[model samples]
Target: MQHRFEDKIIDTVIYTALLVLSLVSLYPFWNALVISLNSGADTSLGGVTVWPRAFTLDNYQVVLSDPRFFRALFMTVLRTVCGTAASIFFTALLAYGLSRKGTMGRKYYMLAAIFTMYFQGGLIPTYLWLRELGLFNNFWVLFVPWIISVWNMIVFRTFFQGLPEGLEESAKIDGCSFRIVLPLSGPVIATLSLFQAVLFWNEWFASGIYINDESLLPVQNYLMNMINSNSAQEMISQLSGVSGGVGDMVTRTITPKSLQMTALMVVSFPIMLVYPFVQKFFVKGVMVGSLKE
Candidate 1:
């Protein structure tokens, strides 16, 4: 009875500790969300916590009403979709070719690819190269520079190697080419696609250098410039870029912090949604190649 009491106490203590840690980790996001959902003016007045003091959609209305915001959102979607698709397609194709042990000059091909991971022309040289290629200030500039991801290739290679050796033999005996065989690597492909999608979605630094067109800006870039502008009026102007319909409601209910938090939530919301859908594959991939094996 003494030992039973001691174990129960220990378990309770451990669970309590974990719960506190979880709350500590989550509180900032909770606070931000509360502030976002609350009346912006009330949020600025302070003391907002886990729940909104006064619930309103004016902050989101300000966000959704902007034409520029929609354009940036569209471009962000394009970058995530197109970049993720192209990266996986090309990286997997190259990885498939390299994974075949029977291929000629495979070592040289792998060496060439690996070399790129460690070395690149410095920023000036890259900028000059883009200029020469006439890619600067263009929407295609976003797509051109992200054609392949070396790290993802290495991961794909590792995952491909971990696939059953007998599967290769079976495919060979069945006389199936890459078209048939590659589709069977769904687990790793889905995992890699998720990885590259997040990368493309979060990427904005490339735009800071290569792109100047307002029309071509992705959400990250647009949000970043507004955040860094460090002026409340400038940020408000961004809110206005969305829609004039929300102008009166936003002016009455919104504040700068509310808009900023909303932008962050907007940036994060899509990826958060995407992860849950692919989470099973993500966990399975990690268990198979990345973490355990």
Candidate 2:
């Protein structure tokens, strides 16, 4: 009876603690959503809580009306898809080659690759190299330099090494090539590709530094610029019918903080939507190379 009582108390305490932590962690995002939904003028007056007191969709309308926003979104999506696919394919190919037993110079190649993880050419030299290649200010500049990742290579190699040799040998005996073996690594690929996708999606620094064309800027960099240099009036002008129309009334209600929160939601929503689908793969992929048969 005493043990049961103690367990119940512990469980209660743990549940309460978790509930408090969850609320604490989620409140800021919730507040941001509420503020984005509320009228910007009203949001500025403060004291708005759980729900919007003056709900309006003008902030999102203002954002969506901008052609640059669509271009940036498209650029970000393109970068994530192309970068993740290229990086994973090339990295996996290298990993597979290195994982093969008796590959010549494997040890030396691995050592050199690992060396890069600890050291990088300084920014000036890297910038000069990119310039010499005429890649600067190009759209591909956002992801070309990241086409290979040493850490991802290491993970891929480890997972590939743990794969049962008998599976490949059986496939080979039936006249199948090594390409058939790649399908067996679905978990690792899916997991790593998701990580790579997120990295590409959230990348802003490369776009900011290497891309000069506004059309080439990814959503993240555009969002950064909007937050840092944009004004409410400038954003208002981007909306149609702002000349003494409903948009004008909407424009009057917009504040920078409200616009910022709306932009944050727009930027974040896609990734949030994607995460759930790949979550199961993530769980399974993380356990790769953890055990051996």
Candidate 3:
């Protein structure tokens, strides 16, 4: 009876703690949504909570109306899809090959891969290297530099090692090769895909460094440019009907900040929509992959 009572108290405390944590974590997203939905000018007045003080769709219209927004979105989606797919395919292939014992100098290659996780060439050197390779201002630049993630490689390799070797051996005995063997690594593949997708989706720094063409900018890079410089103001200036009025020192109420929030939502919404679908697969994959270790 005492133990039962203690468990109930513990459960209550945990639930309360979790609820508080959830709200704390969710607040930033809620605030962004509120700001995005509010009148651009009204948001300047501040004090927005979960609900918009003055609801308006102008911010969305302003951001969506811009052609560059669509282009950036397209580039972001393309980079994520292509990068994730390629990384999963190639990384899994590498992991599988490395998982097998006696793969000839595998230790040296693995050591080299691990070495990179601890060190990277500074920006200028990397930039010069990209320049020499003619990857500057190139779409291919996004893929090549990030083609392999050493940390992810290690995780995948560990998971692959945990998997049974008999599956591959049986298939090989029947004249099948790794192509057949690779697809069977379902949990690890799903797990790696989620990680790689998120990594590729959030890419901005490399784009800024390698891409000089404005049209090729990924969505996050575009957003970062808007956030840090006059680009957001310039973009906002391009927005029509941002007119706000007053007889006594009237000024435009909508600021670039609101537009920034709107722009933020434009890129984030797709990811939010996508996460639900992949979440179960991702969780299952992670659990199974981690089971052995």
Candidate 4:
């Protein structure tokens, strides 16, 4: 009876600790949501806390109405789709080739991949190379530079290596080629493909560095310019007509904390929606692929 009571106490403590940690991790997202929904007046007055003190959808309405917002969102979606597809196709092909133990010149390919991970021609040289290739200011610039990630390739290769040798041998006896073997490697492919999708979706640095044209801006770059541009402040002042001060004007224009939170929510919503569906495959991939046989 005493031992049973002690075990119950331990379980209770563990559950309570986990509950606390979950709440702590989730607090910021909850706070951001609350702030985004609160009225600008209430937000400026610091009325929002854990819950919104005054409800308003005006912030989202304003953000969505802006043409730049839609343009950036569209470009980001395009980049994510194209980049992820290209990454999965090339990474799968390379990884499968590398998984074969005695494939000729495999060492050189492996060395080339590893060398890329450790060192690169710095940004300027890469930019100059891109310029020389005439890929500058092109939409292909987003997908081409990141067709394969070395780390992703390694992960995929290890996963391929871990597949049962019997499967390949059976396929070979049936006169099946490497192409046939590839279609059969679906789970690992899905896992790597999802990883590539997440990387492409979250990326902003490439867009920021390579894309200067307003039409080419990804969501991150668009949001960055919105946050930095002086004209944004003037527009905010005209809309709200709240002459709180220059400090207030700057706050309203450059980084309306509420609007920034809304932008973050917008940018992250698609990924968050996607992650739940792919999460099981992601975990499975990492667990099965992490260990080398």
lDDT tens string, model 3, 31-107?
A: 99889888877777768878998887767766787788889999888988898888887787787677779699899
Error of 1 at 63 (Å): 1.3
TM-score of each: 0.85, 0.91, 0.90, 0.85
What's the distance in Å from true for residue 181, model 2? 2.2
Q: Output the TM-score of candidate 3.
A: 0.90
Report how far off residue 288 is in candidate 2 (Å): 1.4
- Candidate 1 per-residue lDDT, tens place, 153-250, comes to 77777767766778777777888756565776777788888888888899999987888888998999878876777644565665555566665666
Error of 3 at 146 (Å): 0.8
* Candidate 4 C-alpha lDDT tens digits along 1-293: 99999999999999999999999999999989988788656677765779888776666766776778898889888988898888888987888899899789998999999999999999999888888888767788877888988888887788778778888787788887565667766666767777777777777777777777889878877667666765355546555655555345334433366677777778878877877777767666667677765
Error of model 1, residue 81, in angstroms: 0.6
Candidate 3 stretches greater than 4 Å from native: 240-253, 291-293
Task: Give the runs in model 1 whose Cα sits over 4 Å from its true position.
Answer: 1-21, 173-175, 230-248, 290-293
**Candidates' lDDT values, in order?**
0.80, 0.86, 0.79, 0.77
Give the local distance difference test score of model 3.
Answer: 0.79
* Best model number under TM-score: 2
Selected candidate, larger lDDT, 1 vs 2:
2
Off by over 4 Å in 2: 1-18, 174-177, 237-241
